[model samples]
Target: MADVKKVATRQSYGEALVELGAEHDDFVVLDADLAAATQTGKFKAAYPDRFFDAGIAESNMVGIAAGIATTGRVAFASTFAMFAAGRAFEQVRNSIGYPHLNVKIGATHAGISVGEDGATHQCNEDIALMRTIPGMTVIVPCDDVEAKAAVRAAYEMEGPVYMRFGRLAVPVVNDADSFEFEIGKGILMREGADVTIVACGLMVQASLEAAEALAAKGISAEVIDMHTIKPLDEDIILESAKKTGRVLTVEEHSVIGGLGDAVCAVLAEKNPVPVKKLGVNDVFGESGPAVDLLHKYGLDAEGVERAVEELLA
Candidate 1:
């Protein structure tokens, strides 16, 4: 596991923004004094004229991004997940979402992986909160390749977008040369028959590892990377559930409004199946190492393997 090359999705986001900035000049970036943390600093440095630091006020940053978007320019507002999704919910929902503006929110340091930042910075409910707003496209990239692709896809699309990037350096799962990304689509990481493991963000790599572990245990566990939460790819989920008969959702965020609930909602209406959730169980995160937090909160590969085993039992 340690041998695999790892890169934080936030870092990928920054590099992707810089690439986009070089290609286009109609887009602008706004940060809530968290350019370095959110990885928008790369874009800021490359395109200083297009980048605007809105100080530490996340809400004000959203308002400014919305205003900029109204002027027919694509606005990418960046901040920690806690501030971008939680603190600026009202402004985002009212000013951007209500009007359906072309604004992309780059939310970094999401979930328990925020580590030493503790519960205050670890945003477990950001996905749930963002899911509530109408026409909000929520995306959680799994690896560096996926994260970079997601950023570019969000920029090409219209309306408001909420993208979550992790602070922890995760394993590179996808082959960069062949990988393709699309909004509201889920990627099949592994094919199996006994059970299905649906995941997003860093959890996708964990789920893939868990699937391999399950394979050794004589359990065929399929792995699906549900990168886009809102407008979820229900077709892929239903197909997997119909084939496996059991579905398990894994995420680094809360078990509440994250990937689990989104999958459950789809299955409940279209294809009902026995489902299990592996994530932070409505609890707060503490200051610790990023890897330790994932293990402690049961968001690691071992935890995912255990969940799959229990689900099949």
Candidate 2:
């Protein structure tokens, strides 16, 4: 056990926005009426003048963010994943992606881990939706440390970015000061020869735990945090798949058009291998505890271990 502290990525996003605001005067934030839930309220409190509450109109908010970006400001639009990536998708695609504006979509409450909010609130297709845009960059940070780093990187990186965040309080897997975050680069957490587990968002911690359990059963599992979903790390996936001979992708999103499909696409072209994907499996989430939903949907540590065992069998 790493004695890791737990924190929601949304909390880290708010804190990071405040820090980035201090560092860059051109940084501006926009929210579509869910500031507190999205944790953009913290940024609004610190820099009230720089924050814009678009009042429930997600499409308008995204358009406003794009307009701000044209004025040479880095606009961070915060809202729930469903609304930001779903309700306002057209605006995001045309206003932000089409123009290639420097707008960061802070999409929180993503995946089945969104808990009691249920299917309407949970978004399992944001990555699939965002990655379709030509110049859009999709990032799903594993923990608070990575979320903060991802926010800073999104600000620095030009063009539109959709960074997914979950509501569940996940274990902090990386040291804040020590971990280095780079766009489109994958981090190989555990090295093994038997199999490889590639994951993103909260599943990274679960995959790490599953790796530890697999180790006890004489099943050596390599764990890689494929944090940047878009621009999938082909080299790392190819290298690991070549060494391990098998790959298992775990995510909180749908099995279709997400991390699993992304990794399989890379492997199918470069180094084809037997791969199994664990995710929501084309179902809508219901109201329940976040942890319970994870277990029910097979996105938890135990579920991952079972998937790996089956893959090796």
Candidate 3:
């Protein structure tokens, strides 16, 4: 069990891949020209022979990963979330998802956290895109510990997996040995009845902060880390919605069809409530610090708190 200190989820994925590669030779690493940025360079250094640098061609890289998976090799393709889900959609859909191949797509620089590079680099639509693909397992770890666990889990699991991570260092929320990662289970971070805050990725930290703010004002907000967006712990979400009359969905992605939409869909069919979505709001991000961009796009802790307040009112 490692310490539960603050660390970026991307770093956890990079470090875990190296450990997994050292243990399993069949575990191969692939990168689409952004090895260093995506942190797959660590695995490349550890296992040079098993690492393949596809060099800027994300689509080709996805196809190669799918090909490798068919050969009984567990292939992990690392790239920015935008390219992995958006640019390599068809390859992932036909080559990987359709076949239900054991291909782990570790998409770093996900959401508005890949700030300074602007909206082009940020992947606000990755969840919606990846979740639409059949047999695809979409996961966004809440912290570094969960990130490491998700990486190991994805490697052992059989199917096309999309594990999303961010570029910036986030507050570590999960204890290394305290919680175990489950494919379709939603972890309850904090419990309340005033409202439920369902969040993923870096926004999990924001959701925690919002819960704390709401607590100060006597508004108890239940915080559920909805890491697996595809399977989506619908039971937990519905239960929370039933307890709380209002629900708030938070993510670093777009509000259109991402985490917010997925939660809304479940709530609409199961337990509908006054759900408020906090995210990019259909606007493109600009070049700035990751934290600044989060604030600008209304995905930060302050924004989440405001949304909760609005819904409560």
lDDT values of the candidates? Answer: 0.93, 0.94, 0.89
Model 3 CA deviation exceeding 4 Å by range: 1-4
What is candidate 3's local distance difference test score?
0.89
- Please give the lDDT score at residue 179 for candidate 3: 79
Per-candidate TM equals 0.99, 0.99, 0.97
Q: State the lDDT of candidate 2 residue by residue for 177-204, as single tens digits.
A: 7899999999999999999999999999
Q: What tens digits encode model 3's per-residue C-alpha lDDT throughout 1-313?
A: 1243667788889999988877888879999999888888898898899999999899999999999999999999999999999999999999999999999999999888888888798878899899899889999998888999999998888888999998988888887778788998999999998989999988888888888888999989999999999888899998889988889899888888888999999988887788898888887778899878888778888999999999888
Candidate 1 matches the true fold with a TM-score of 0.99
Off by over 4 Å in 1: none
The stretch of ten residues in a row with the least summed lDDT in candidate 3 is 1-10
The candidate 1 region of ten consecutive residues with least summed lDDT is 208-217
Off by over 4 Å in 2: 1-3
Candidate rank order under TM-score = 1, 2, 3
Q: After superposition, how far is residue 32 of candidate 1 from its true place, in Å?
A: 1.0
- lDDT by residue (1-313, candidate 1, tens digit) is 7899999999999999999998999999999888888889999888899999999899999999999999999999999999999998999999999999999999999999999999999999999999999999999999999999999999999999999999999999999999999999899989999998999999999988888887888999899999999989999999999999999999888899888999999999999999998888988899999899889888899999999888888
> Residue 71's C-alpha lDDT in candidate 3?
93
